[model samples]
Target: MYHIRASILFCGITFVFNFVRADYLTIKEERSYADPPTGDWVTNGVITPLDQEMRNFYIRNADGVIEVLLNEDVQIGLQTRVQRGGFEERKVEFTIGGKRFSYDLPKNLYVKRMFKDAEAVRKWEERGRRPIMDGKLYLKPIADHLPTPEQPWISGKFIRENGRFIDVQIGREIFQIGTQGHDGQHRFMGLLGQKDIKPFIQQAFVHGKLRGDVFHASELCLRMLEDSKAQDDPKLGRYLFIGDSISGNYDKALRTALKGKLNIYHPPTNCGPVRKGVENIAVVRRMTNRGLVGM
Candidate 1:
């Protein structure tokens, strides 16, 4: 196991990454809360329904549209009250997939329940991915330089510190920063709002240049183990790859590249999505000796 300490400047912010080697490190998806409504007239909520009350509904965001299965009929529970000037304020509360969410409908907004397609629902559930925003934030990676095992990849981390926003792109994936609600927490939505991506790029990029720090996965694992000063163990330096089918391919490639170099671990079953990652984080943390790193 080895350690590499590196620093870089991004968006006028300095970020330091500590890399270490271990038998295993966890790689999971990134998850964040949907952005809050921008005005008083708009509100947000989660949908969670009872097990027996299954239904299908469509959710549209700027990036794309997806149909979600609601465990209950949501329209039947819609509540409306008269506002000033003969306007109506509509609201609904429902549960889906064990999570409760709610949304306030605009005066003229229309929502329809789609006919259930078991196969479609199954496939959607299988994807295990969710939209990062209620509307479009236009967050897309530049295709100029593709990430590879040789060069690896780096992503920007938007952090809120002392009531100010500091944006920095580190070599490691965004998920390595840890979960939300911790000190030095990082979020993509907190720094940029929905709708336009132009302004975000303009502010985050200095003179249209993006700076990134680089570290090979093996080197990172060594650094992590060394930093923890974990005692030598045959099973100590392993890397666990967990994600959906897309991520599965990545795992295979990584395993091939790192063959005979490090111990790579992955489950027979591919992990579903960010939600699944959130659910199984504790188990992954427990399995890894030095701790998990997100991708």
Candidate 2:
């Protein structure tokens, strides 16, 4: 038995990738959180749910399954394992696949990054392969660009010094970036009251149209929603959530989980542990504005 090992230097660190061929051939890759300098991949198959609880599922090619899971770091997006308990199973075709991708694949954002169908695998085999590397802050340009887009859209260091946005630098350009995540909910009745991003470096996709030094993306569920005040949506009617600490306790989460479907508001009067919560119901009604709710 023989193992071939290759080392790549990225950013400032070194990474070792080993290719072992024998009984069962497999490609194992390990690298920093950042993705490609540039490129993409195309795969064909229908993603099937395996175990909703474990966040496990897979794409089927010929027979069995290559069970996959949603990256724990990712909480939102089409690749999310978070069960909607959908009314019906969807026939989806590679939401992130069938397109170009770069080396800076965000495991958090591209939850299905590892999946490759037979045709895609064949393409990989035909194009060729490379070993893994280390230090995501730096990446060497690809000699032969696979998955098209021969040139990297951008390459540089990304850091979240603080707050919800990341500090990014690509060439002479310096930008603060934030990924657009899950859609929020609207709490109608009683409204009122609502993270630092992870830092990395070297090569990654900047989803949004660039503006000054900040990158804002629209739909890639990879952010944490904090607490603050609630605003009603004129499109949807408002909803009043009345309860004690239990209801109040889960109010924020309920709003997030709802994906901003309803305008949810917890009456300030019933927001905490009150000695006489039920009695406060009347107080809440009296406190709120006119015709806001029918409580």
Candidate 3:
């Protein structure tokens, strides 16, 4: 009787353990790669044999890899891998059938998101999240045309024109981009309308210097644009702002700042009549009109 009872208890415990495991799925890497190539991938979302409700799948491939099987051949975001301490998780995004999904993927997995669309890849690099894929850094261009915001200004990363490398500080859903240089100058840029300009400008000058950068400086004020342009590296070819007078005024400043290496291609091939939608400039003008100065 004792032997039989003990055997039954052991079997029961084994069954319970197996049952719990079956409820969850784990996909771990059996191998690792430093730089997994970039491209489009379709995954079989069902990892376990009994996967019925198919909700999430674990991706464990290597340092720079994420194993993802698609649910219905839908497009997905790029996933990249970064050396654990070298890169931080970015809230990269993707969409399937109009439903958006975001993952805090590493740099390596991030590069994978650019597959299928070279343009997408270019934009990702400009965001400055450093995938460094293909053993060399590459910058992809953003879509030629995007709908202008009704408020007449592009917002945040959307204004960069390149979607990949522009890095920004995020606060309460707000994206801030810029940094200070050794010369006591603050450099930054973004897509915001009139309302946001004062707060941003004030923040930069509160410390007693107009060391910040604005993304939507209208070309109408060429002097302002030129002075601001002399603060960055243009040869990097990572990001370039191309527009009309707004962009033109900054042309020489941009060249001087970058040592005459970077060039701005005026009259954006995609968005001509650049002055038509100068919402950012309008905001600047409004700020000036209100007698708010220095930022």
Root-mean-square deviation of every model: 24.7, 24.9, 30.0
Tens digits of per-residue lDDT, candidate 3, 1-295, equal: 0110000011112111110111222323232221123321222111111123322222211111122222332222122222222224433343322344443422221111123244544554467534222211112322222112222111222112122232321222322222222232211211112222211112111000111221111100000112122333444332233343332455445546655553322212222343332211212222223222211
Poorly placed runs, candidate 2 (over 4 Å) = 1-149, 161-164, 183-295
Question: Model 1 shows how many backbone clashes?
Answer: 34
Query: What are the per-residue Cα lDDT tens digits for candidate 1 across 1-295?
Result: 5453333222223345554434332111121122222111111111112123323222122111222332221112222211232213333334322344444433332111111234433443356521111111012332222123333322333221112222222344221212122222212221122112111011111000111211011000000001111222355454544444454346556657767665554432335554453333222212233343322
User: Candidate 2 lDDT, tens digit per residue, 122-205?
Assistant: 454465532211112212231221222332222245333223333444445444433222222110100100121211100111
Please tell me which predicted candidate would have the highest lDDT against the true structure. 2
Q: What is the C-alpha lDDT of each candidate?
A: 0.26, 0.28, 0.23
The estimated TM-scores of all candidates read 0.18, 0.19, 0.16
Q: Name model 1 segments beyond 4 Å from true.
A: 1-236, 281-295
Better of 1 and 3 by TM-score: 1
